[model samples]
Target chain A: MPTIWVYAEIDNGKLDPSSLELATKARELGDVEAVVLGPGATEAAARLGEYGAEIVYASDDQVYADYVAQPHVHALTELIGENAPDMILFAMNYDSRDIAGRLSARLGSTLMSNVLEIESVERAKTAIIGGTIIVDVALEGAPKILLARAKSFVAEPLEGGEATVVPVETTVPEEAKRAKRVERHEEAATGPKLEDAPVVLSGGRGLQGPDNFKHLEDLASAIGNTAVGATRAVVDAGWVPYSYQIGQTGKTVKPSVYIAFGVSGATQHIVGMKGAKRIIAINKDEEAPIFQISDLGVVGDALKIIPQLIEEVKSRKG
Target chain B: MNIAVCVKHIPDPNVPPQMDGKYLKREGIQGVLDPGDEFGVEAGLLLKEAHGGEVTLVSMGPAAAQEAIRRGLSMGADKGVLVTDDTLKGADALVTARVLAAAIKKAGQFDLVVAGVESTDGYTGTMPGSLAELLDLPQVTFAKTIEVTDGTVKVNRQTAEGYHVVECSLPALLTVTAGVNEPRYASFKGIMAAKKKPVETWSVADLGLAGEDVAIKQDVAGQTPAEERKAGEVITDDGSAAKRIADFLQEAKVI
Candidate 1:
């Protein structure tokens, strides 16, 4: 069987959930190893064993002591060369993506991101295309790289397995110290919680300005529990956070119900929300690309249409 | 200073997202620069152009993602690298970051690495912070503006509540939000320049990563499409349009 590797993340001795999911997916393809880095990774290594990692690769060197890319690169790259696993699994985190990208580029295999399921083990060589998720690509290669979204894979519990925690020490390049950690201030997320929200209500440049979102919000409020999003134009205009923008550059989501207000439907915007099941769009421009894919279309001014739709829904329910 | 920017090629979402069962069917779609990441790429290019340094666009997701890097190069990056390994297919956020970290280190030197705060397809939005943790790189997430002078970086960041300023040294990791700079479109000349740039390809082993290193840490619990949105019947023309509209809302319990 192929050896599948997952980048098991350890922070203060706890394993991150995304890594666990990658471990689970890796198990499907072949034997699994959970790779951990940093001083606290020992605790994380043991936890990974409990979760089902057949082997734990731990790197705790001065360079890796604090989570620098150079050492992790040194350790993991060396590890991949030594083990020759058939598959590599990683979460779609920032560093994970870069590492995967770098590795894939070096290895000459395709890296697929935001994957939802495993169609078949035979097709592990293939890359997944688009957000709707339909293909299992089997590339002709010894080892391939795979990236899964955090919540997209369902990790099953393993009966009983002890992961082999192996401590790894690698040399830290002089440049490793160039990047250091500073303080991070997290803001309370308000506008739209994309990952957790079931429905999303988005506004585009067609809305004209931020104040117009008041009406779009009225519709969202009527829907209740839906998060709000924006197009790049609005996000660039300072109407919303870059986090809320949806398109080629923004967040790609698969919501159950997505309502596009005043969006003239750019192709970039469409890629982000196309996975949504039910697409409802209201735009004065019926020819907007968004209308082409929308399950339901209302040709009218979004500002006018949204409030009226909100009122109509309220009146109907009452 | 040397900088690296990670970019991905994504299908245009404005078109019908072709699907086969649970898979997103990627065919016949134009791959373009992930608009979200364009901000990050633009940030890197502008910094390099102003600061007199090299900007390497690293695309490790898939061979297809190289297109995105070419787009970045056209925007004025110095070089390009594409890491293509099948093992990276469907990798979760953690492995994705690890692979990137591996590539960045092996690529030799970089004072900074920038990426879009989040990818357009994954929408996890956790990678930036997670990357900071993994890379141990001082980071500024959701940066709106970044001004670097004499190796000291000053940034205007977008918090969920409002914007804030952050200062840091060089050789850090940063996740950029939109408005870090208005991403400039590629002119014909710029496009030609990208073709003249160099693109290096690497593999998992080439970057010094063992094949069976990182394992899955979490499962994708479940994915339910956005909740169904019911469309209220349209009542147009006639004197009854307003009444019908009102009646629909009353029945739907909106008002």
Candidate 2:
């Protein structure tokens, strides 16, 4: 079997679940190995092994976290040079994209992003045209670098023995330390994350104004485990934070049910939420593009219907 | 200070994409400057206004892509450098970066490079990083706010949780996210002035690269329509829409 390497990430002593998900999926294509770096790499290696990583290359160096992606790129370039794997899987994220892009440039190889599935070592599936078309892309080169969208695969830990732990040692060149991260600010958010929520309630420009988002919050409260999302229009209008934006640039969600209030279904917004198992959109325009893919389409003013929907949901639950 | 901003001309996002066999059909669709790149243009203009430097717009695409650069020039960029050739038709991100890096070098000496975090059409979000790597420059991505001082650049980099305050020296690259700045529409005067702006067109050979050097690495083996979500019942509100939706939610077992 071919050997596949997963670039795992660790933050604040916690391993990103997407790494485990990729590791699990990689087992089917080839032997699975993982390279983890950051503060908790040593601690996260065992969990990676449980998720089908036969070998775990780990380093607990602060350099990976202290600087931007260059240090990690330095380490990964060395690791890949020493032990060339047939393919490398990266979970699409801010840092992963940075590292993968740089690594691809350094290696003079091509990197494919927004991959949704791996059919085999040679072929992968990606969505284009705002998730309306699914295409199988041929992985052309050895050590193919693939950045998979998060939540693309189920992360299931296997009952297996401990993996052989390998140490990754490399000195970060001074040039790689040019960009320094001085401070981190975490925006405090309550409720389930949009990606993990079972139900999602989204607002769009048709909601009329920013203050109207309260109706969405109320409705989300009535429906347990629901997170609020916003279209790119409203988010760009400063009606909501970037975290609440759902689209090509923002987070991709595959909730069990996605309820959009006043969303006109721009192609950008649809790509982020089309993966939801059930979609219900409410808009005054019967011709709204959102209705094209919605499981239940409601033609009406969202401002008029949201309060009633919130009340109906609350009363039914009671 | 000299600044270079990478911009892209793409199929208008408002128009639904059409497929020609396994590839996207770009023959007869309306094209526009990628919406995301507008923020980069605005950022470069702001930097130029603050630091007293010329902003050079750089792009790679077919001849029609000049429209994208024209839009940028109309936004206050001083000049434009476009690398357009038939071989660059399906160039991947790395190849595009190599071409852009060569073009940027040929354009002039630049202390800073600005770009959108990703193109709206491709949405790969890797161009700036790859370009920075090939150019051997310090890099920052997802910048919501940028400040330049003597020989140093500071940025408020957006992250999943919040933001990071990052610092890099001059001769660096940074990618700006949407909402970083309000992009101004081209005034009539600016639109007319853009006609006089110098836009140099370069081929792959002009940049000292061969067609084989930029060959695409990924291929679309096959394409199939995504499984369509069947349209369900539609109900117009006459004061009962909410109740029907609640019932539908109950039936779906998701509430």
TM-score of chain B, candidates 1 onward in order:
0.86, 0.95
Q: Return the number of clashes found in candidate 1.
A: 146
For model 1, the stretches where C-alpha displacement exceeds 4 angstroms are: A8-21, A36-52, A56-68, A105-110, A113-136, A150-152, A155-174, A247-252, A264-268, A316-318, B1-144, B152-178, B183-255
Candidate 1 C-alpha lDDT tens digits along A45-131? 767776678889886543453433445655677788888877677765544654564455444444555555554433532122332
**lDDT per model vs. reference:** 0.66, 0.87
TM-score of each: 0.61, 0.97
Question: Candidate 2 residues A129-233, lDDT tens each?
Answer: 867788888877778899987778899888864678898878888888989999988767689998899899999989989999987888888888889989988
Q: What TM-score would candidate 2 get against the native?
A: 0.97
Each prediction's DockQ against the real complex = 0.11, 0.73
